[model samples]
Structures are given as structure tokens and as C-alpha cells.
Target: MKPLNPGEPRQVGRYRIIAEIGEGGMGRVVLGLAPDGRLVALKQLHAQFAHDPRFRERFRREVATSRLVSGAYTAAVMDADAEAETPWLASVFVTGPSLKEAVDAAGPLPVESVRLLASALAAALTEIHRAGLIHRDLKPSNIILTSDGPRVIDFGIARVAEDAQDLTGTGAIIGSPAFMSPEQAGTGQVTGASDVFALGAILVMAATGRGPFTGPTAPQTLYNVVHGTADLSDVPEEIRRLAEPCLAKDPARRPTPEQILNHLGPVPPGVAPWPPAVHARIRQQDAEVRSVLALPLPVWRPPPKKMAPRTKKILFGSLAAVVLLLVSGIVALGLSIAEYAKPEDPGVASLAVTEAVSPERLRLTDPCKVLAGRFVKESGTLKPESGSLHPARCKYTGLNGVTFNLQLGESVTVSGLERTDRTAEGLPLLRSTISGGCDSVVQLPAERRFGIVVSRSGKEGDPCKSADDMLTAALARLRTHEVDRAGDPASILPLDPCAVADPAVVGKNIANAESAPRTLRICEWQGGGNTLTVELNLGAYVADGSPVDLGNGVTGDLRGAGTTKCTVHWQHRPLPNREAEHVTVMMLGREGSGSSCDPAKEIAASIVPKLPKP
Candidate 1:
């Protein structure tokens, strides 16, 4: 490969001139912006490689295989026209040093980070295998360590193992020698297991800052990788265990992706469910956003203020970072809260665990909060038509057995009640009102939405003499629920509507709340029939108006325990009778005296009653 003349346009089909990102005996990879404005690393085939019909066929197969493999951990194939003049291909431009560069500049990654990297890459290879393709070339140069996470790049040599007989024609060495699996070198075919073998080699490099199989020449490295054993003596126990399975001499002995995820450990309870891929993407985006934000604003700005090209790049990068941060923050905040919950105090709050009965048999004297942070009282359980009260069915299996699920809309419901129940201190286990389809219910713990089956058969004890004891039990339940629902990353961030009010109005309320500390402004808006939006100015509790760390901002939502005179109407309409009765109770404690507070209920006089009988 030779360098092109300066300012001379080099075209590969529709792709225009761009600087080269990498060059080798096979070809050169040019950096180009796609027609749609996506940065793509375009690999342009050198004349020598392109002229070989065998290589062209292999390259075409690589493009097809790459397109079939779609994963968050892998660099996505954006565009490729293999049949074109120069047979160009493009992938998402990952901006960061390669793994080789990182290791060379900063030394080997920490042990924990290395393990994380191995697990992530192992998981990515699992996807590649699932797609019926093998990344024959898994080398350090092809591994991109971007702000988001490690992305497996360069699928140029990737091929389906099943087609190896037809594609390879005769057994031939095709991939990097040091990372090649024994099967790849011998049979010219790489299976899902082959990637596992390569992953072990990569882990060895990440751990000791050197490849396990090394040689001054490619042939020597190939010889060692084909017959030699990896040195795990230097690898830490924690990571060595992970690498050992991948390094299994017999591919059948290696762990599958599902098995690998299981070995990652039990998922924390009460957090939003996320599969490994989404979970990884979330962390990657979060880190990338934080990194961009940490850069000085002026430093991130374009050199020429109004230059169209530079200005566009700056705007694109900045916008991308901000969006990533906002979304990640919302998700992380929700998951973190569920993951980290302090135990309830012993003196103030107590916990009680009980069996669940049929829909009409269960009972509740106190109000309860469900999945969406919504609250319901005991009276809400009765049906208007029959005037007959229904209970959320709770079953008994030996001892502790109950499953609780609560969804909100017209009324609350429990679905698919299982033999499971968990406890939480200060978490009100109120009554549930059945409405619409999906009739199922179970009680939930604080900072958690899932239920668990307690060990009721054990030594009989409430474990609720004090709030502290109840809290300890509740934390256990939270952790349990998190593991059960491990998938669906969207659940990580529950939707939260912002409180709309003038800053000046909020400022005035803050001043009053600080000085008088007793006066609170409660405003309500009718969200049409069966809905309302209540605004309670907690002043400082709304701190910077951020939804997270909402201190003392518990209004009529769950925390108020049906005591606050604030409620937000969800839908925009008037109630059928232009009225729905509700009450608000406020208590003012002496200075630093929340415990000394007294009850004061403010009931709405003569509001609309329940829906007219059918």
C-alpha cells in the first residue's frame, strides 16, 4: 500500500476522499462522513487485494455476515456495497484509541476492569455466534476502547463456520496468528467456541499487558497458539476463573453466553430489568456523557466560530453528549434508588407479614403504595355494582409465599399472584382496588415493586419489633426482586412528569417555607375527568427542581399517606359530576420537631360521588 498524493480525491464508489485511519498489507481504512451525516470508518480495498477473486468473495461474505450480527457491543455495519467498483464498507466511527494503543500508553487495565472487559467481550462474541458468524480476527487492533465500551471492529475476515468448506476451499491460515483458535488454524473454520478461545488470549493480554502466545514473527505465534498453553499463573483468581472456561482446549467445555451471564452473579433486587447488552449500553453512554461534560465548554467549541464544517461537528457532538447524559441520568437514578435503600428505623415503623387470600377475602386497614408510586386506601377495594368488597388473593405455601403485582390506571389490580411475599419497613401495604382487565395482586416492599415469598416455615417471628428490624428485612426483599426481573432496560427509568410553575412562584414559596416553615402552597388543576395535577411547593425540597434527591417533597404522592391536600390530576377532564371528594391533612411541628406534629385534615366538602350504578 502506498500513500495517495495530497489534495488528490480518492473515490471508492460514492465515498469521497478522507484521511486513512489504518493501513496494512490487505488494504487501508479511510475515515469518511456518510451522506446522511454519520461518521463511518470506510475500508477501501487495495488494488492488490481487490484483484484476487478469491479474496473478493471472502470480503463479500464478510460484509453479509457482519450485517447479520447486530449487537450493542459490536460496531454496527451502517453501509456496505461489496459489489461496487472498489468494494467499500462502512461502520460507525468509534472515536477512541484502540485496545493496543490504550495498553501501550497506560499499561494494562486494572484487574476488575479487565474482568469486566472480558465478560463484555465474551458476551459480544456470544451474539456473533448466535448470528451464525465467527469473528475469525479478534485482535487488539480490531478492539475499539471507546468512551461507550469496547466495540469489536473489523468484520472483514469474519465468516460463517458452517460455510467454511465452500469458502476456504482448502485449509488456509486467514486470521491473526496470535489470536487464532486451534480449529481456525487446522480446519480453517471458526465456531462460537473459537471466539471463546480468542477471548482468553485477549484477557491474558489485558491482565499481564502481554499476549499469552507471542512470537517475533506471525508463523511462530501461530505455532504457539496452535500447540502451546496459556499462562494463567499470573492472572488473578477472579479473572482467571473467567478466562479458564474460554481457554478450554475442547470447545465443548467452554461456557455459553447464558451461562456466562449467570456467572456474573445475582442481579440486585428492585432495579429496572435489563439484559446484559442494554445494561452495558447504559453504562457506556453514561460514561461517555460524563466524559464529554467534564471537558471545558470552550475547549469543546469549534476553532472557527461560524465555519459551517467545524460548527456542525461541534454542535452534533455536544447535542449527542447532552442527550445521552439526560437519558442515562434518568435511568441510573431510578435503578440506583431501588438498588440502595436504607433500613427503616425500629421505633417509628414496624413490619407485618401475612398470607394473601382470594380477591374478596384479603383485607387492608391502611393505605398502600404500588409500582407507580400511586396510593390507594382500604375503601377503594369495594366494587360499586355489587357493593361487595374483594380481596387481593394471597396464597400460603408452607410459610412465606406470596407474589404481588400492581398496575395503575382506573383502579389497581394484582396479576399472576405467585407463592411469594417480601417485607419493607415504613412501606405502607395498603388495600388494592381491582379495575379493568388483569386481576392479580401482591404486596410490595419500600424502594421496591416486586413481592417475595418469605421463609414462613422457619422459626416463627415477625422480625418487626422495631422499624430498624423491619427495614433490614425489607432490604433483603428489595435485593431478591431485582434478580427476578433482570431484562428490559427501559424499565430502569420510570417516567416522571415535571412540576410546572413559575420560578418566581417557587422562589416565594421557598422563602415562606424557610421562615414560617409551616405555610405550604397547594395548587390543583383538573386533568379532565378522573384526573388531576396537584402542585405542592416543597420549596427547598424541590432543590434545583431536579427529580432526583427530592427531600421532604412528599406531597399527596405515596409519602403523604393521604394526609397532604395536594394531588395531581393525570388526565385533563372534569369528573362526571364535576366533583370527586378528597381530603388533605397537614401538621406543623415545632422547630426541628417532625415527631411533635399533630394531625389536621382538610376534607373537600360535598364533591362528586363514585360512578353512577350501571
Candidate 2:
């Protein structure tokens, strides 16, 4: 979990946001504390989809279906507002790592555990199907392995069974390709059987490291889902017997939840059900829940009870706790919290940014020395470029036309926990964004001057892996004090990318401009059409644009004048001194509606003079 970003609203309806829970393909999910002291998972749709009427209708339906679902094995919707600026839904926060995370971390569940999971899941599906809903996007990630049982969540694409079967009516297909049933793969009639197929696939994934339908791509995976038999090599024999029928290609041949539950028999009461690792994860979640509840608030009283033994015990405990709370005040609450707080991970460093070790000592050392490693050798020839004003930088234009740049400097980024990893040196390394091509930072000490950054510009393979590998090599070389310096080291790092455009200029093009520095060189403003991102020095030229003047010898290329996206780039730095250093301004319109390139050129013109002179 992380603090909310700048644009994210802290209050959604009756919920007060704490931090981000996680993000999915659709949008972000934030952890919110409800007024009644209950914690909730709040999902806010992305602006892209929020503007789509079809998506709004689907979200409306999802809220309705999720509210209808109720059981120990399913997350239920608690509140929602479909008419908000950005539609949102709030559900009870079920605490646990996703089933996928569990399997990935601990490997497959034991045979007995899988059997128990199967029985519980079948019963859950029976309830959902009974309510006339088909969980169209059932996958390992959507299943929460709670202490009591599995709880299904994120019914983002769920629709009533009686609704026509086009899962991707006007939007993209939603379900995991590997877990889809043949009917879903073909976009045909999807019923409860489809969920059964997904369950079978999920179990196979649980038993093995991979899904049953193996493929190199989504289309191929969908093909395998329709044609190939499940790869059940590692599944335990008895569990396989129950899972195989559910994986049958023909939905008609698949066993219903009732039949599967009957075959699996009754689950014994009082069983702790989940594996050790899963239980450990549950404990972590339990701690998080307690921490959320421990926030300062008005003293809450115990609600009327049903007068059972468990209720009496709970009441008695509450009375004692309340007495202690009244007598000891907030100190008692703090003590209660201290007892349940999770132990910190020893491998992770303190988030405090340490003082940066000045690269000034290595000024004479080639900045390219940072690139002296296996990944660099594989990437081909190193080319010197000065288009960007940043000091201590070099670039390599690979054979595939992908350019990789290494900047030895300090930078701030929108790094997420999902993308954070430790270098061999154990420095705090992180990806710039959950979704981005390449950016790695050895976060400097709070008072440090700079951190090492290895960035690649292109749509390529795993950027994080590439970045981490390069960072490792860079740190190892930096230790030797034998640097491979390149380009001019005397120069200071370039002006902040956002500084190139004044707020007034930004406001002129995008309303209510709020600047977010993605990196030292890339800045984004989210207001007009929700977002207008600017990446500086990404490339030299625009493929299709009419050259135009932005005053004082600066020239710009305007592209897509009448189209939905209008972009204008001004080459702020002159040629020969460096590769073209340009600033791009974009206006991302909704759907097929957008402004003319004239506005883009106007914004470009306004900022051209502010940029450093050629």
C-alpha cells in the first residue's frame, strides 16, 4: 500500500482514503476507512473508461451484481456512486494475497489443500450462479485466499447470465486468456460452466506454476483454451480427477458446481484450511486491518449481540478493552496496536532518502563506464548524444532501433511497491511507474546529491529486469573508482522538464493544470481530458509533422492537427552540438474528438523561449 497520488481524491463518498491497495488492468483500488470504522476497498475507474457510456453501464451492473453476492467466500459490495465524475465502487476489504501471489510465492497447494479449496470454491460459485450472475473475469488474481476460505472479487466485467453473451461488446475482452472457457474464448454463450472452466484452470495454476493452457500470446492462449487439453502434469492424482471434468472443452460436458461439491464431499468444521505460507500472508493482512482500525477516532461501542457464547465472549472482551481504553486513553490504543504490528522486512531498506554520494569524484570517469557490462555488450555500439542538457549521459542505438540512455544523476519518480527491488548492493531500486518502458533508480540518501539511473526508450522486454541488471553492473563498476566517462561532465543537469513550460502555458492548453514530474526529464500534467503527458528527448523527430517556427530560431513540428491527439514538438537545442533536444506538448482528446494542432503549436511557442538557449 502507498500514499495517494496528487490527483487522487482523499474522500470518495463516505469513505476516507488511507492508501492505495493495488491496481488492476481497469483502474486503481484504494483502501478507505468507512465512517463506521470498517475498512473498504474502493475502485475508481480510469478516465479513459469513465467517459465510455458502455463501460459506465457495465460498471453500474457490476455494482449491482457485487452487492447481490453474499457469502463467506465472496467479497460483497458495501457502497457505490455510479454518477460521480469518475465512477467508483466500494467493497468490504477482504484481507489476503491473491491466490496467484500465494501460488507464485509458495508453489502449488498441497493435495488436501487443493481438495478443500475446490470444495469451497464450488460452493461459492453455486451461490453466485444461483443469483443469476456469471463471473466473466474469474482468474487466480481475483480469488482471495482468506483464512476462512477463498473469496472471489473484482467482478468488473460480470454480467447477468441471461444477458446476451458478447463479453467484449464495445470494449476489450476482460478475462485472463489462459483461464477462459471455450465459450468465453469464442465470445459465445457464457454460463456457470465458464466459471467452472476458469476454476479448473486456476487449480491447475495452483498445482503447477503455470496455467493449463500454455501459449506464447493471448490469441494463442485463447486457442489452446478452445482446443488443447490441460497440461496437468504436476497435479496430484485425486485433485486431478476432480479438476479434469471442469476443464472439459465442451461446456455441456463440464460438471456443475453442485456435482463437483457432491463429489468432493463435506468440508470438516474447525479446519484452518489454508497452507502455512497463506496463513502467514493472512496474518500480515490481519495486522494491516488492525492498523487501519487503530487510527484515532471517536470511541465506538459494541453493537447489540445475538447472545451466543461467541458473542458473550466478544462482549466481555470489548467491555474490558473499553474500560482500559477509558482509563488509559490513547496510550491503551497504542499498546493494543503494538501487539499486532507486523515485523519489518529485514531485506528492505529504510525509505528515508540518504544523502547522495556526489558523482563529482568520478567527473573525469566516462559516464559510459556505467554501461560496461554484459547487457551493454549485447545491446551493441555506444553512441554519444548531447541533445539533452543533462550532464553525465550516454546513449546506445541498438540494431533494433531501440535507444538506451544512461543518466548518472538524481531523480524523483512515481515508483510503486510492485516495482521495487533491492540491488546486490542492497540500495533501494525501483521502476519509475508500474507501467513504463525503463527507469531504475538507486534512491539516494535523503541528503545525497544524485542516484544512478539507467533508462531505455522504447517498447521492449521487461524494463525492470533490464534496468536492474544495468544498475547492478553500474554499482559494481562505480565501486572500483574506474569509471567509463562519456560526453561532457562539466555541464550541470538540464532544467526540470516541467520548468520548460510555465503553468500559464500549460493552463492555456490544458485546464486546471497539475504538474507531475514523471522523471527529471519527463513531466505530465493531468487536467484537460484528465491527462497530457510530456516526455522530453524521447526521440529526434516526429514521423509526420509540418515544420513550423516557435520564434527566436526555434522550430517545431506539428502533428495530427484535426485528429483526436494533437502533438507539437519544439527542437530547443540546435543541431551538431547534440542530438535534437525537443519538448513535446500533447492534447489527448476523448474518443475521436480533439483540438487542432494550432493550440499545441501555441503552447509549444509559449515554452520555447523558456528552454535553455542553443
Candidate 3:
């Protein structure tokens, strides 16, 4: 939640608005306090929709039906005013983060947690359908995870079953593409079964952090919903068994809410249904709401002012002089505060850094831009290499046999590092010198650090000095030109390499295999004296090997490296500039292991079919 901005309404009807909760394509939501002191989440429609008389009538009817929905797992709609200038509806406020936020912050849910989530959602659907309403949108963001259990919120898009056709007459899609049912993707009929399909997709996301049929673009995703297969390879076996039937191409084959509840059996009892990190977030939000409620509401009054033109002009001149003096004083005080806030201890200093930068903001940052060619030139006459194996890394090599490597979003340990007085954009810088290289780390939020390493074959010059110079240049560029990943949904830069590959295929290729993520874009499986590494990166595709057909109309370049290693690389799609989004599957085995390319080809074939097409 955030503080209300100027010009925002302080009160709507009988409820006093506290703060803005969030906003979506449809309208804005705010935390409101009822006259009786009950906390509620109130949603107000956009003014454009309120101007339409026919929409107002439909909204009035839908709100009435929504009020009838009363289930343990659903947020009960308390009241609404469809006749108001901007129609608004109030519902019970549930203190928790949305499923999307929880998953993005804390990663995917465990199997037990996922099972509990499924059961609660199924129960909520039963109540909604029973009231003759169908929730057209049931994505992760629409579900809230509380301490007790999950609550399905946001029925704003819901309508009576008989009225769905009328609502869709304009042929506008009504739901999120990743979660839409095959029927909804096309112009087919939508029913409660459509919700069931969305539930299955939600379950897949809860289990794997990615939807079963997600494509890069909305149109591509919709096409996948109608024709492509659901990718459940990353989903756990326990949940996949239940989600499979719900994703059936035929709506008649899908299970009803009651059937789903029966299949899942009873939900086990638990005080905390979410992971500890997620529970911490819930507690933080709860505290914030309490603090906000404790503060007294501000009283508004009109100013009383009457002055002659000459007197007003004289007062304005005096006011401007006083304001200039006050501004000068404030600037001096701010400088003193900044100096006082900089702690000597690195741990305490990191707290201030955390408040300035957030993990969500860092997730979209491009590491390559942080260590650009111009920044590298500041240290020496070094030139950038093609690209690193991961998207969050870059490499530069100089003709003088010097190499510099930079990586972003790393979990670094700074206990033994030497703290320096130098800082990059107010972020503390730590240094360490090793055998032939010097490393510098810039502490960021949540222990995430950025590293700059300078290496040389001989100690001809101070590598530490070079590392420091590059760090200064990188930080300066980050302040002015922090490059971000492409906004294109089809870009593979945001995907997890480990989750993209089929786990079963990896197991088949390497016996008793165990998977571990080396970086955000790299995953490795090792067992039985063999190792397989999968990487998702951005670079120019190397067409140096024979092109072999992979399944799903994709082809990959198969090449061998020496006697023990083989690699299969494929371009998923062309990116901006001369680079392309690509994947690499490399197999490494004992020296005597025969023809690793065969298994590498097989693994690449399995992964190619699951990726989103360009």
C-alpha cells in the first residue's frame, strides 16, 4: 500500500479512504475504514466506464450477484453503489500479499502448500458458481494468501452465466492470456468449466512459477491455449496428476469444483499456510495497516484571505525572500544529515542502502550495460568480448593479457573483505585481493552484490587500481543510463533455465541426476560421472556445426568439443542489435564416454519443444 497523493478523495460514501492499495486495468483499489470501524478493500471503477449507462446497469446486476457469494475462501462483498458517479464496491479486507507477489519474492510453493492452495481455491469456486456467477479472471494476482489459508478475491469481471454472451459480444477477451481456457481463447462458450481451466494453470504456476501455456505475447499465448500442449514437466508429480485433467482440450472432460475437492481429499490443518518469508511480508503489511489506522485523519478547511492588490504584492515579495533563506538552511541541514547517516560499520551502512534500492527494481536491470565498452576503456584499452554465458554477466579482454569480468545479482559474503572509504553512488564498496586478480563488490539490497574482477597473468601493474577505476565508471553509468531488459514478453531473458528444461529428460540422460542452478540463466545436472549444463543467454548464434532438426519445428546446431564434451545450441528468437536469444545444452563425461553429442541432441530436442516460439 502507498500514501494517497494530492487531489485523491479522502472519503467515498460512508467509508474513509486510508491509502491506495493498487490499481489494475479496470479500476483503483483502496483501503477504507467503514463508519463502524471495520477495514475493507474498496474498488472504484474508472470514470470512462461509469459514463456508459448500459455498463452501469450491468455492473449493478453483477454487484448484486457478487454480494450473494459467501464462502470461507472468498472475500465477501459487503456493499456497493452502482448509481454513484464512479461505481464502487467494498469487500472484506484480507491482510496478505497476492499469490503473484509471494511467488515472485519467495519462489514457487512447495507441494503441500500448493495442495492446500488448490483445495481452498476449489472451495471458493464452488461458492462463486453456486451463486450463478462466473469469475472470468482467476489469475495468481487475483488470489490472496493469508495466514489461515488462501482467499480468492477480485470478482469485478464476474457476471451471471446467462449474461456472459452479452458481455462478450464485442469479441474482446476478458481474461489473462496465460490463464485463459481454450474456449475463452477462441470465440467459444465460456462456463464454470472455463474457470476450472484457469485453476489448472494457476496450480501449474504455484508449483513451478510459470504458467503451463505461457507464450511471450498475448496473441501467441492465446494461440497456444487453443492449439499448443500444456508444459507440466516442471510441475511436481503430485500436483501434475490433478492439474492434467483440468487442462483437457474438451471442457466436458474437465472436473467440476466439487469433483476437484473430492480428488484432493481434505486439506490438512496448519497455522501458517505460506512459507516463512511470505509470512514475514504478511506481518509487515499488517503492521503498516495498523499504523495507518492509528494516525488521526487530517481535517480540511478553506483559507480565509482578503487583501488589497498593493498589500498582496508586498507580502509576496517578503515571502519569497524568507523562502530562499529557508531553502538554503534546509540544504545545509540535509548535507549534515547525509554525513551523519553514513555509518562506519558496513553492516549498519547496508541498511541505508536497502532503503534506496529494491530487489524488484534490480531484477529488470541489464548487467551488460553496467560494464559497457566505454566504462571498460576508462580502466585500460580493453575491448568487450562477445557475451558471457549468462545474461547477468559480461566479459572484457585486453590485448595486454588482462581480463575483466563483471557479474550482477550475486549473493556475496563480505565478512572477510576489506572495507574502504570509497563508495559508488552512496553504496559501500568492499575489496579483496587474490592470487592474480583483485575483486570489488558493491553491496546492494538483500545481500545482493555486484562484483568486478580484474585479472592478469603477471603483476605488471596494480590490478586493484584497475578494478577501482572500472567500478567508478560502472557506477556513474548506472546512475545516468541503467539499461533494462527488453520489454518484449517473448524475450527469454526473464526465464529460469532450470525450470525450462524437462526434468524427466535430464534424469533419463544422467542416472541418479541432481539439478542445481549455477546462476539465474544457467542450470547443471550431474550424476553417474556425467554432467549436463543448460544456459539461456543473449549473443550472436554460432552456425559452425551441422543443423539437426529438433521437435516442434525447431532446429539446433550440434557440435562436438574435443573427446569428452559435446554441445547443442539453438536460437530461440532474434533480439535487438546483432544478438539473438539462444539456448545451449552441453554434455560432459569421462574421457572414454562414447559420443556425448547423441545425448546432448536428445536433451536439446526435449527442451526445444517446451519453449515459447518467436
Candidate 4:
């Protein structure tokens, strides 16, 4: 069977498919519209898996278990067809991206975001376990940052032990290994605590760009997970303390889901009060069951009322005596129960809020000193050569170095080499900015700016073109170093390699011209550090003769023109200083414009070198 394409409209039962939202090894999930035009996410298991009778039975059990659970933080399932040829289930569609994707695209999320997310997800787990279900897979991918809060999804593998026939196979891994609980990885006995372990992993990932355990091989990673301690030195104290217990190697030592929820602080009353709507629905379904069960008609029989007068009198007298005794007993019992139910000395109840910690201060020594003497300051321009343009003034560790304090919507640039008598502090402390975009931030190392080369291209639209030769020389100064991980294969890119390739000059034809259809490629290079290069290829269908329109932005008419294949280039700053904010680079095409244009690179060069004097 063909997989569903994005934005292609179709229907399964009452659910109308809108578009493909995401996919994984299990199956494809589509953003669907119901008959009433409400949005939903429809997850369809692959036809191959649907053929397995055991899988179908497990899926049905999952549906029943989910129906029994209720929570605002969990995605509600609207409909499901486990018996279908290609079984599918539809749930309320959450708007934002997954935690992993968000962090990948925008660095780490903020502290507030992390706290709120933790509380919400823990509450969701509370509801899940309360309903007698355990969510086996609770990694970042299953968490959606919706408008209200983070919603946990994909309950397909949730198990109700009594109903489960071990459909996933004994000892088969169900969740992402990096986030899996020890019990889950070893025995496949998924309990609510598994989600707690996953939550701990999520917190680390939110604080750092990567997960807790990274290894070159899966076995090594698993071993590290099962035996090694999590490296959470980079995490803030408040968060680290709160999360440490969740990752306890011993399941017994781990906090329960309720305990985790309590640690998140209190939720206002009535937000998700008792007797949730799901419970009501369950009761209604039970009533329907009762009606079905009672449908079996019984043989009708008439009662005979032909008793002797004396016998009737005796029976009435006995009944009256019994009623008097029952009334007295009921009164006595009610009094005893009411006295016991009296509130016992209202126990002290106080709410504790999670603490907020400030950012850390980076220390420097004399060899790392940044000299203000090297900068060339003009009335409206600040020019920094290879050894100039230190951004801050600070004294620490018997040396004067540049102090870096970046705030939201603000940025500072550093240039210059710090040569130390010893090899320990030879490289420049500032390298590149570590950010996924405007909203996220990551940290980079400092040894990338030695032995510089600089070059400039004399192009009109190219801001750094005049200094192309010097810039190239500066680019040549960078050397690559590899940062290897153990279990996971994804690598972290560094700032040095970014300096080599001019992001502005990489794909000029595709992005500079209007109506130019081009394929953009971002390739990561291997060496001393991580490097990414972008390539743009023009397509034949794109009309080069006429102008095409690009979209709008902060500056008016962000529109571009022409069908020329313009390739834009950009390299990421490996790690941003504490105060350095993230930046977004957009590629636009216009008619008759030169091919080598990178919005981010152009902006960085034009604005960076000309920063105002402090």
C-alpha cells in the first residue's frame, strides 16, 4: 500500500486525512480533519504489521487501556479501528514540534519552558497510571509542545499487564535506549517509573543539546546507561537536583509518578478535577454493557397471593418488629461513621515552588586577555582585525579578558588571537555561536581562532567581499576536531570548520534570482570539528527569464526576483557565549541579482564588523 502524502485529502471511516505530520519505524501519522473540520493526528500502522494477528490484539488492548485513562496533558484519542486492514488511530493534533526537533532546530529550551513541560508531562503520567496503564515509550519524540502544555502521545505500546500477551516479545526493546529504564531494557516490564526515567532523560536533553548517554556502539551505550552515572555537570543545580532521583539505576530508588508530580509543584484545583470526562464516558460504556447483558429475557411467572388470614397477620407483626430494629441499628452506625470522618487536626499543607538559578560565570587567565588597544574605532563603525575587537572588560584569574554577557535580542562579536607562553591557553576563547535559531542556545569550545587568514570579494551586494582575501585567510585559520559519541551516531559541529566556507558565497544562483527552482543541500564535514556546507542546484522547470517572488520579513518587500539559481552560504558559531543570542538566516531569490548571496552571512558581516563602540 502507498504511504499517505502531505496535504493530500482523503478519508478513513469518518476521519479525513489532511497531511502527513510525521513518521517513524512503527508507522506514519497524518494531520487529519474530521467531518466537523476539527484537526486530529491519525496514526496508521504499516500494512505489514497489520497482518499479524497478535499485533492487532495488542492494538485493541492499547485502545481499551487508553480509553480508561484521562488527563489534560495526554493527547486524547478521538477514534480508532484496530481491526482495519491497515489499523489506524486518530488523536487530537498538537500544534508545536516534538521536543527533540525543537531543541535541534532551536538549541536548548528555556528554564521556564522546561519547568512547565516537566509539570505537564508528569501530570499526564499520573493520569495514565491512575487508569492502570503504563506508557512504555516516553522519549522526547513522543512529547509535543502544544499551546497549553507538553502533551505525551503514542500510547500504542502502553501495556495493561493483565491484558497483555507479551505482543512485543519477551525482552524486546520498546522505547529509545538512551531514555529507557533499566527494567524496560532488561526484562520488558514497563511500569510507570519507566516514564519517570524518560522524563529525566528529557530534562537533560532540554538543558543540553544531547541526551545523557552517547557511545560509539549500541552495546556500549546500553552498558553506560545500565551501569554508569549520568554526566549532568552542565545542568543547573536546581534542575539537576530535581532530576537526579528520576534516573536512579534501581527502579525501587526511582520516584513514583505521583512523587514526580509533587516535585513539579502544585496544580490549581479543578484544572483536571476528579471524575474526569473520560471516567464519565467509561461509566456510560459500562451502562451500555449492562443493558446488553440484561437483554437475555427470563421466563415470566405470576406470583400467587392466596395466604390464610392468620398467617398474614403473623407475617405483618414480624415485619413491623424487624423494621423497628433496623432503624435503631442504622442510626447508631451513622453516628459512629460521622464521628470518625471528622477532619483530624488539619495537617499543615504548604506549596513549594521549584527554585530558579542564574547562569554561570566563565573565568579566564592572563594569556587569554583581550586588548581593547587593537580595535579601530570610527564615529559610526567598529573594525576588528584578527587581534582586535574584544567585546567585554573583566579581570579574573590574574588576567584581564573580555567579559561576555549576551541578552535576548542582543549580540556581541569577538575577534583576536590570545597566544599563551604555554599550550594550555593558546587559542582564542571565543569561537562561534551555538544556537539552533533565534529562540535556542548551545555552548561551543574556545580553541578555534588561531593562525588566521582573511579574504574579501569585491562584489556590490557582498558586504564582506571587499575583505574576501583577508576573510579567506581568517577561514584558513580554522582547524577541524572530531567530537565522538558512543551510542548515538549524530555529531556536534564546531565553530572552526564554519570559518572555512563562506556561507554567503555557497549557493548564489538559486537564492539570488527570482523564479529559480533549486535544491538546497546542507552537508556536514568530518574532521577536528563539525562543519556544515550548503549547496543549491537550479531546476529546469524554474523560469529564469521572469522574476519570481520570495516571501516578506522585518525589512519591507523581503521579496526576491529572477529565476537564477542562487546559492547562499552560512556556518554556525560552534558555541555561543553566555550572552550571545541565536540568529535566523533566510534565503531569498530575486531577478537579476548576483548568485552569491546569503541573508544570514550577509547580515552577519554587514552588522558584525560595524558594531558601535561601548
Q: Which candidate should be chosen as best, given lDDT against the real structure?
A: 3
Candidate 3: global Cα-lDDT?
A: 0.77
Tens-place lDDT per residue, model 2, 1-614, is 66567775567777778878887767789988787778899999876578768778878888777788887788888999886768999998988888899988888888777887888788889888888898888888998888888888888877887763543563234578888888776656788899999989888887776898866444446655765668888887887888899999888999999999899888988888778988998899889767755665333333233357788799999999998867587565564323223322112111122212333333334565445332443344334453544435776554356566677655544334344647546576766643357777765543233556777666566656666776766665565433523222111123455655657767876778798655445677877564566755533444358888888787677788787678877655434544455677776766744565666677777766544334
Q: Worst ten-residue run, lDDT, model 1? A: 605-614
- Clashes per model (N, Cα, C within 3 A): 47, 17, 0, 60
What Cα-based lDDT does every candidate model obtain?
0.47, 0.68, 0.77, 0.48
TM-score of each: 0.43, 0.49, 0.51, 0.44
Put down candidate 4 lDDT per residue, 1-614, tens digits, no spaces.
12355544366657655445667656778766676657678888865467658667877887777777767888898888876667888888766667776777667766656776678878888888888877888888888765455789899878885544277765346677788777775554567788788889888888787777644334435545665578887877777887789889877788887787677687554342211332343345345434533443223233234567799899999999999898688787674322222222211111111000000011101111221111111111112233211221121111122122221111223332222232211222222223311111111222111112111212223322212222222112111000011111111111111222343443332233212101111222222221223321111221222222222211212122232233222221222332221122234333344432334244333322211111
Q: Choose 1 or 4, whichever is better by TM-score.
A: 4
lDDT of 3 by residue, 536-598 (tens): 777787677888888888888888845579989889998666689899999998778787887
Error of 4 at 56 (Å): 1.6
Candidate 1: regions farther than 4 A off: 1-4, 266-614
Error of 1 at 222 (Å): 2.5
Lowest-sum lDDT 10-residue window in model 4:
352-361
